[model samples]
Target: MMDMLLRPRIILDAAEAEDAEALAEIHATGFRRGWSADEIDALIADKTVSSHVLRRESLFGVRRPQGFILIRTVADQAEVLTIVVAPAARGRGYGRRLMEAALRALYRDLVPEIFLEVDEKNASAVSLYRSLGFVEVGRRKGYYAEDHGPGGTALVLRLKLR
Candidate 1:
């Protein structure tokens, strides 16, 4: 196998309340409906998942990802409430890494199963989740508030781990 070398220095930390504005801006730039500053703040400040943020600081500027994986645990099960990558950061593997982190965090919590909802039109995201072993379990009619394109419903996926 070919060896990979070098990686971005991403500092994974819980998002501070102050980071919400930047987060929402980045998300808005990346997705169809960029969350409002207030919305992002609410999501991050929510007690449910204790949301996380990935940051990288340099002399030029600090890179604070607007997207995240919001997960919550219920008994032995974990649910991924949301996952996003900044518009400018897509295709850079941040989404996948964030996903891996979320899964690992849940695993560390001894969660044996995980589930999430995704827009069915988001083929890229669906592929990623499937690659990570999540299978489609159901669908929600008109679940997506805003759409990427083609306007599709939400798909529910689940992964059961040993």
Candidate 2:
């Protein structure tokens, strides 16, 4: 589905190192700790791995990349490496749109399911996944370390893409 605002113009750019600097800022802003430019470059530059940024109309400041999702296809499945949205864009439904686009882009044919891990304490994010029919499949102990009291666990969730 196309973005309403962009209206037949949503541009999905394969993020490069040059875009990493800006992506790092957004990632750091969304998560407490963001990756460095080199880190983003490493993850995105791998030809086998797919990294993308969703721009409203174009890559320019049309709507400065409100969200991002990274995926790596493994066999008949695709694992979501990371997904984030700018703090200011959190409640605007960008997260949902990003997930939808990511799933369609990466696993439209071979993969029938997609999986990801999410911090258990992130209620909003959990809710969003559940709303998209993601069911809890497992859990990882102490996966997220934060500045808060103690780092929380991560819940593994999966959704059938059929």
Candidate 3:
């Protein structure tokens, strides 16, 4: 848990071209199959994709990115491609804030519904999504492979924005 007094000021902003490397680095901390900077750059260049980066600014004015959320929209629906927060920054409400900001942006853009897939075993993530009004619509059997054991299922969740 992060100490309240020690937590830095946080800012959430639309991701830009320069954020590709930072986004990739933060993503690598959370997932086994992380995206490369080049791949992130390509995705961000797409018109249908929108991304947000969360940054923390210290009292000394040093700023560093802590997390990011990437979304892709087609027609009236949007999908959360990824959401990652640095391990040290977890449990400090950054993930919830990032998701809130991303959802607001998608709603403003007229997206009627949003969807995402999460590993069924990730209790914290599942609880977070449920708190944000995402309900499970389906599940994929063995959608996520593990190194030491059998694969895990992926729960497909959807949130109605309109």
Pairs that collide, model 3: none
* Best model per TM-score: 3
lDDT score for candidate 2 against the true structure: 0.77
Instruction: Give a tens-digit lDDT track for model 1, residues 1-162.
Output: 222223435776777778777777776664667778787778676666656676754445666564676677777877886677776677877788888877777777678999898888788999999999999999987676644653558899999866
Put down candidate 3 lDDT per residue, 1-162, tens digits, no spaces. Answer: 558768788888888888899889999998879999999999989999988888999978877889999999999999999999998899998999999999999889888999999999899999999999999999998788888666889999999999
RMSD each, Å? 4.3, 4.0, 3.0
lDDT of candidate 1 at residue 59, scale 0 to 100: 41
List runs of model 1 lying over 4 Å from the truth.
1-8, 30-32, 60-63, 145-151
What are the lDDT figures for the candidates, one per model? Answer: 0.74, 0.77, 0.91
Instruction: TM-score each candidate.
Output: 0.80, 0.82, 0.92
Worst 10 residues of 1 by lDDT: 1-10
Of 1 and 2, the candidate ranking higher by lDDT: 2
